[model samples]
Target chain A: MGASLLVLMIPILYRIIMGPTGFDRILGVNVIGTKTAVILVIIGTLFDRVDMFVDFAIAYALLNFVGAIVVSRYFNRTVPLQEMEKPKPRRRAKV
Target chain B: MKRTAFILVLLIGLLLAWAARDFPAWGDPHSPASSSAVSSHFIANTGVDTEVPNMVTAVLADYRGFDTMFETVVVFIAGLAVFSILRGGPNRRTRDREFVVDFEPDLIVTNTVRLIVPVIQIFALYVLAHGHVSPGGGFQGGVAMGASFILIALSWDLKTALARFPIERCFTVAALGIVIYAGIGLLSMFLGGEFLDYAHLAKVFPVSPEMARYHAMLGVEIGVGFTVTAIMFALYAGLSTDGRMRDGL
Candidate 1:
C-alpha cells in the first residue's frame, strides 16, 4: 500500500512543480503532505512505533496548514496583470 | 488523460486492498487487532483506571485522549478548508451552475432518501452518545451524519438541501468543537497529570475517580463527534453545491 502511494506521489510532485496556476500547485503539495502524514502514521502502527510517528503526524499536520496558508495568502495578495492598465475590454467588461 | 488517471487510481486502490488481504478480518473478536499488546493494555488497565463500559472508547477518549484531541483539530482544518474553498470566490452569491448526475432518480427513491435523512441523523446521535459502550465512536458517527447530508443533497435541489443547515454555521461549530477539546486537554495539563489526564475532572465530578475519568473522556468524545460531524457535513455541502452558493438557499 505504501509503495503504491509512493508511486502516486511522484506525479503529484511533478504537477506541483509544473502546474501553471499557483493555487493548483499549492493544492497538490497540500494533498501530498496530508497523504504523507497518514502513510507515516499507518507505517508507524504497522511497525509498532506508533508513539514517535503520532508526534510526527501532529507536527506534519501543523506544517501542512502553514504551507497551505502561506501559499493561499501569496495567491490572495498577487496583483492582477490587468491592473497594470493594459486594455482588454471584452474580458475587462466581463469582470 | 482522464481515463489514464482513472485507471491508475483504480489499479492502485485495488492493489492496496489486495495487500491488506492478510490483515485480520473485520470485527473478529479474537484477531490480533483485538488481542494485541495495546488492546491488552487497555483491557488490564481500563477496569481499574477508567471503569468505562467500552474498552475501545476508554482507549480513544482517555488513554489516547491526546490523539483524539488532535483528530478534532484535523476535522477543524478540513472544515476550514471546505469553508474557505466555498467562500473564496470574488462574489459571495454567484449563480449556481448546473451539473447533471448520469442516473435519473425515481420519485420513490427520492422520497425514500428524504425520509431516511432524519432517521439516519438520529442513529448517528445514538452512535455518538453510546460510544463508550459500543463498537461505533465519534468518527463512525460523524461519517453517518455526513452520509445523511449526502442523501439529502442527492434527493433534493441544492438550495433545498442547504436550507436544512447553514454551511457557515457548521464551520463555526466545527472550529468551536476543536477549541473545546483542546481547552479540556489544557485544563488537564494545568492540573498536572499530562496533557489529557482526567484526574481533575474526576475531582470535580464527585464520582469514583475511575468513573469520573470515564465521564470526562465521554465529554471529550462528544466534542470530537461534534467537530467531525460538522466538518464532514461541510465537505458534503460544498461538494453538493459546486463552486458557488445556490440561489434562495
Candidate 2:
C-alpha cells in the first residue's frame, strides 16, 4: 500500500518539475505533501506502532500546510508569472 | 565549471556510498553500536535511573544534558546574529522588491489560520509535555509553536504578528529560556551534585531521585521550547522584512 502511494507520487513529481504555471507546481507540491502524510500513517501501521507514527504524520501534515501557505502568500502579489521568470539585470561594479 | 562541479559531487556521492557499505544492517543486534557496553548500559539502566520510558529523551535531557544546553545556546546565538545583521537598515521601497506584495489579507486564509493556530499550539504543548513517553521534545514543540505565529504572519501581515509577539520580547523570551535551563543546572550544583545532575533536584522537591530526574527533564524541555519558539518567530520576522520588522511576507 505504501509502495503504491509512492508510485502515485511520480505523476505529481512530474507536474512539479514540468508545470508551466507556478500555481500548477504549488498545487502539485501540496498534493504530494498530503499524500506523504498518508504514507507516514501507512508506515506506522506496518511497524505496528500506529500511536507513535500518528504524531509524526500530524506534524508532517501541519508543516506541509504551512509550507504551501507560505508559497501561496509569497506569490499573492500583482507581479505576472512571466516577469518572475526573467533574470534581473546586473548593475556594473564600481571601480 | 558546472560539469566539473557535477563530477566532483558525483565522486563525493560515490565515496559516501562506498563508505556506507561498512555500516551494519538496520537493527542488527550484533552491530558495533548495538553490542557496545555503553548502549547496553543505557538500554538497561535508563528506566531504572530516570523512569523515563523514552530513552532518547532521558539521554538528551538527563545523561548528556550539558550538550543540549549548549545546543540551545547555539540556537539563541544564530537568532541573535540574524537579528543584528538584518535589523534597522534603510528600508527598501516597494518598487525595488522582486515581488511587490500589495493586497489585503484574504478572508478565507485568515479565517482558516485563526481556526487552526490554537490547535497547532495545543499540539505543540502536548509534544513538549509528553516527551517522556513519546518521540517529541522541546525543539519539535518550539518549532510548531513558532510556525503558528508564522502562520499568523502569513495569513495577515508581519505587523499583526509582531503586535502579538513583539520583537523585543522575542529576545527576552529567548534569553529567559537559557536562564531557566542553566538555573536548573546551577540549582542542582548548589544542591551538592554536578551541573545538570537532575537527580539532585530531589533535594528541593519532595520526590524520589528518579522522579526528580523525570520532572527536571520536563522543565528543561520547557526552557528549550521557550527559546526555540521565540527564535523561530524572530528569524522569520527578521528575514522577511530584512529587519525593519514591517510589511513582511
Candidate 3:
C-alpha cells in the first residue's frame, strides 16, 4: 500500500517541479498532501498503531484542505489586471 | 548569480544528506530519546500518575502544564500582534485609487461547503474530546474547527463567515480560552497546591487526585482549542484583507 502511494506521488512531484502554471503546481501540491495523509495511515497500519496515527492522518488531511483553500483564495483575489482602470464609454454632445 | 545560488543550494543539500548517515537507523530502540532513562520513567509512570491513556497528552498538558499554558499565551499574543499591525483601516494614501474585488461565490462550491461544514465541525470536536485515547488534541482539533469557518468564507464571502463569527466575538472567545486555562491553575494554587498542579484540583472538586488531573487536562485541552480556533480565524481575517476587513479576499 505504501509503495503504491509513493508511486502515485511521482507524477504529483513532477507537476510540482515543472508545471507551467501556478494553479497546476498548487493542484499538484494538494494531491501530494492528500497522498501523504493516506501514506501516514498506511504506515500506522503497518506498525499496528492505527489508533494513535489516525489522528495525525486526520489533522494532515484537514490542514491540506486549508492550505489549498488559502492558496486558491489568495490567487483568486489578486489577479494582476483586476485593479486596472476600465475604459470609459464615449458620449455624443447634444446638438 | 543564479548559478552561484544553485551551486550553493546543491552543496547544502548534499552536505545535509551526507550528515543523515550518522543519525540512528529507523525505529532504532537504542536511539537517544527511546533509550533515555527519563522516557523509561515517563513510560512506566504516566498511566499511574495521570490515568490518561495517551502518554503525549499526559506529558504535554500535565507534566509540562506551565509550558503548554505559555504556549497558549504565545498563540494569543501572536493573534494580538497581527491585529495590532493589520487591524488599522485601509490606508488613506490609496483611498482615492479605490481597491475593488471581483469575487463571485460559486454555486457548486457554496453547496459543497454547506454539506461539509457541519461534519468538519463535529469531527473537530471529536478530535478535541478524544485526545485522551488517540493522537488528536487541542491544536489539531482547533485548526479543523477554524478550517470549517474558513471554508464558509471561501464558499461565500468574508462578510458571510464574519456574520456568523464576528470580530468582537473572536477577541472575546480568544480571551475567554486563556482565562479558562489560567483560572484552573490559579484555582488549584489557591486550594493549597502549586501552580498548574492538577492533582490537587481534587481539593476543590469531589474526585480522586488522579481523576482530577485527568479531567483538568481535558479542560485545558478545551481551552487551548478555543484560543487556537479564534486565532486561526483572526489570522485569516487580518491577512485576507489589509486588515480593513470591509471587503476581504
- Listed for every candidate in order, the interface RMSD values in angstroms are 15.0, 4.0, 3.5
Clash numbers, per candidate: 0, 0, 0
Better of 2 and 3 by TM-score: 2
Per-residue alpha-carbon lDDT of model 1 for B21-97, expressed as tens digits?
98877888889778889878777888788777778788778877877777778768866777687767677665444
lDDT of 1 by residue, A1-95 (tens): 87788899999989988887666687897889899888998898887978646645654553344345334333332234335355545534222
Which regions of candidate 3 are displaced past 4 Å?
Answer: A56-72, A75-95, B1-13, B88-97
The local lDDT score (0 to 100) that residue B49 gets in candidate 1 is 87
TM-score of the B chain in each candidate versus the native B chain: 0.74, 0.93, 0.93
Candidate 3 residue lDDT tens string, B83-175:
878765556345343446677876776776787788789889999998898877898899899889988887678889999999889889999
In candidate 1, stretches whose alpha carbon ends up further than 4 angstroms from where it belongs are A1-95, B1-39, B86-107, B190-192, B247-249
Q: Candidate 1 docking category?
A: incorrect
Show model 2 residue runs off by greater than 4 Å. A78-95, B88-101
**RMSD in angstroms, all models?**
14.9, 5.9, 5.8
> How high is the DockQ of candidate 2?
0.35
Pairs with steric clashes in candidate 2: none
lDDT of candidate 1 at residue B187, scale 0 to 100? 76
For every model in order, the fraction of real contacts preserved is 0.00, 0.55, 0.35
> Which window of 10 residues has the lowest lDDT sum in candidate 2 chain A?
A75-84
Worst 10 residues of 3 chain A by lDDT: A78-87
- Assess candidate 2 and give its lDDT: 0.90
